[model samples]
Target: MQELPGVGLVERARAVAPLIAREADEIERSRRLTPSVVAVLIENGLYRALLPQSLGGAEAPIETFMQMLEEIAKADASTAWCLGQCSVCAMIAAWLDPDTAQEIFNVAPGILAWGAIAHEARSVEGGYRVTARWDFASGSRQASWLGAHVRIVEADGTPRKNADGSPEVRTILFPVASATLHDVWQAIGLAGTGTDSYEVADLFIPERFTAFRDVPAALREPGPLYRIGTGATFSLGFAAVSLGVARATLDAAIALARAKHPSLAGTAMRDNQAVQGLIGRTEGDLRAAGAYLYATAHTMWRDLCATGEFSAAHRSAVRLAATWTIHQSAKVVDAAYHMAGATAVFRSQPFERRFRDMHAIAQQIQARDTHYEDVGKAILAGG
Candidate 1:
């Protein structure tokens, strides 16, 4: 791993987020960033940290990615959501062969924004023509590229067959100019994420630009970094998002609690034993969540960098740990909301914003019922 400079990208990201925090409510209502706010994040290089140095990027560690995302999310979930997705897009740029990597990244390093996961892709004479309606393309509104998972289909546009008549899935990359974005991210919470839909009709992607989702641990044709799994990156990065939102929630609750008193009226809210206990509990949960999350994510990534031998089981463990941290964050934020009482409910209160954001975090599939079940099943089967 390259040694980063003092204060680090994570700390710098936090420093830049305070202003955005002030506008989180507006962001939730507006469903997109104001132009000025968007510029602040872009100048800060938040989107390119996951990109490789060859492309004039930070190439920061997974832990740094999380810390940065958490800070961005703390300010505005939608901005962070979109920005985080863009950062992940840079991940694809870092994994391809150098020649292909240069074509997408060298000309405009840290500029590509992508969406989608490997659902399927297949071979063709010139390249790969892909089809899929990738949902949750969080950065589609400001992206220059679109990506999705697609399987090979016949010349007639039907799914192709394998020798055994089975199936295979692959990642497909397409320039944003060739795709269409569907503005359908209308929800009651985190509306600012602008996670609209994108579709590509017979978009042909050059073979050199595509990276298989399941390359071996850190083994790219030209760079070992290409071997890492996309899931690993998402697990670590999303966990940081959870942490950031939780931290913001706590900060807001503390500020509100200090200014107000408990309705039961024995003391100021901050001075109340129950409130203190909840705060104390929330702090504990946040601490454990962060500690476990960073420890597990860093361990796996470090092991991969050191020996290039991290197993699928190890990766699964990181996924479980990251998801669990998010779950813990939700629990703590819920307690913060309860402790803040009525103040937490008002739109003027940051708690109201954080409350919604935290709920959204817990509700995301990665942090919710499905991930929990995956972890549970894995543990039961000794995964």
Candidate 2:
């Protein structure tokens, strides 16, 4: 099938869902995506969804990207999480020089992943020298390149500051071979993501390989998608992933309710009024949360495309919607898991894995309760 920018990506994702579902167990067992799953994702151009078109990417609309992730997530949350992490990382190409961007991301399987901001780079002639370790690099196992977000410090250890007097942070890019990978990703869920730690000791990165991420003045690409920024894109994509997980879990519960009968009770679960009521309420909650997330993303995307601007209000709206959707999705999964009773605790059932994945997603930084506080402060301050 021919793929066009921002077109039919959701269908492509759905087409691949069954394969992803089949590989889900192997993925968790290996703590990384299977080669088959990775090939399908790359072959379908899913990883390039957020990359600029100039770099041979889809440059898809944000809503389209979210929908695509939602579909993949219904099959496997880990696959969706890895895809979301790497796809958002591709936005850095927009802030980089054309030659540099092409050199880094134009190659086959051009995937990059990074961890949380940590440590600092000491300034040197023509580049900066970094000797720092970063953690939580989801999808790093499959990435050809890895990046580090660090504050810049001068030779004598003085900090480099922007004109506004804030300390400067830049994302430094390097080949994955330059870093020492650590196998420390043991977790309660989302094990397939390979969200591990990596370290680079006294490594030198050329100035050309660094980017001032999320800073408008440093952007080299003029696409509206980049205006949404990586952080916000991640929030939007992961929210959709949560929705997918919740949807699947609830569906599994409904199926169980229809077929399952209590040992002592005379009626099937579907005949229980309490089970019927819970299913109705949970389905409504899931659908409503998904609608709110998609509507908020579409509104921001429309205004951005027309005006070439992404307002602070737009960012706040996305943050609120994404965080709330994740929390609500978790609640849906919890209800569904409980509704499944003893079956949910067994590894053989669908509810067990999704229940764990939903909680893990909720525990992530994107789903933090502090986002609500941030949005509240922004509203009260009239932002």
Candidate 3:
């Protein structure tokens, strides 16, 4: 197992940010990360941050993962988005059998990407059979393996139930070659992710290749990092990515203000009291959002490490912090974009791409307003 070559994960991500930044336009134009960018990511071990150390992965703390994504997003949000998607997907290895996990993640360019739950897997002899299509697979373009989350049913088509009476859902993994990919990721922003849809008809997955992901009872690894659910980890990572985009956009605005003189204005934009105040206020907002997110993640991580358990309160706090940070980051980006005036609308300017990418991040399921409602309900219930 080759070790990550750098001072740390966050530093490594920051060091590679410029390389990805140079490739940003090409990445967006091609609607996928350039081969060079992908190679850099793999070589740096950024894709293996969340995998178990037992498998030669960094297995860094959630806070480290969040910070890493933020740094990457400072250069390119699409790259950050893809990295976060695939990194969190690696958590499935904790629930898989040791040999199976080794086979899937311990190989060269070991990358796994999966989509949302969209179908059912029928229980059969020794395993299950599934014929379903899943969408929004963000990093499929670079994944060697693909996965689908589906509810399980018996051979007679009867839905399998957990101890709590809810339907059982299993994530079935298979080589990417076994599925058919569709080119359907065209969008206003984050176009480089290649978040296409995929389908597999009448495919049989062996029992060894399926796992009860995100379920506490099924974890085969005893690491504190895997204690937090995959969904929450994703929320944290993407929220950090949002902050990075917002930070870069605001910095660009600040740079423009320092150099540009408005038409007919007596002085540079930076000399304007209004622009100074806006910059100050937006900076404070962005800082506060980032602080809150990191604080929440740190507190939860400490508690989980000490107690070896994750509570409902921890989940609610993380969801609230992640959602609020994403929304606040969008506001910062919007303010910065408007403050840049005519320069922001031009394709050549840095502001436009980050603006589009920030909005696209907000539009993702993790940023939905319903998350706030869920947090509110949890608080009201004294959870």
Best by lDDT: 2
**Positional deviation of residue 34's Cα in model 2 after best superposition, in angstroms:** 0.7
Ranking under lDDT, best-scoring first? Answer: 2, 3, 1
In TM-score terms, which candidate is top? 2
Error of 1 at 361 (Å): 2.1
- Tens-digit per-residue lDDT, 1-383, candidate 3: 66442228898899999999999999999999999999999998999999988788888888889999999999999999999999999999999988998989987678999999889999999999989899999999999999989999999999999999999999999999999999999999999999999999999999999999988888988989888979999999999999999999999999999999999889899999999999999999999999999999999999999999889899999999999999999999999999999889999999999999999999998899999999889878878
Instruction: Kindly indicate the candidate among 2 and 3 with the higher TM-score.
Output: 2
State the lDDT of candidate 2 residue by residue for 287-373, as single tens digits.
999999999999999999999999999999999999999999999999999999988999999998998899999999999999999
What TM-score fits each model? 0.88, 0.98, 0.98
> C-alpha displacement of 330 in model 2, angstroms?
0.3
TM-score for candidate 3, please give it. 0.98
Worst 10 residues of 1 by lDDT: 217-226
Model 3, residue 13: what's the lDDT?
A: 95
Residue 366 of model 2: what lDDT?
94
Q: Candidate 1 on 249-328: residue-level lDDT in tens?
A: 88788887788965669887777887778788789889988999988877877787787666767767777887888888
Model 1, CA-based lDDT: 0.71
| Shift of residue 272 alpha carbon in model 1, Å | 1.6
lDDT, residue 140, model 1: 68
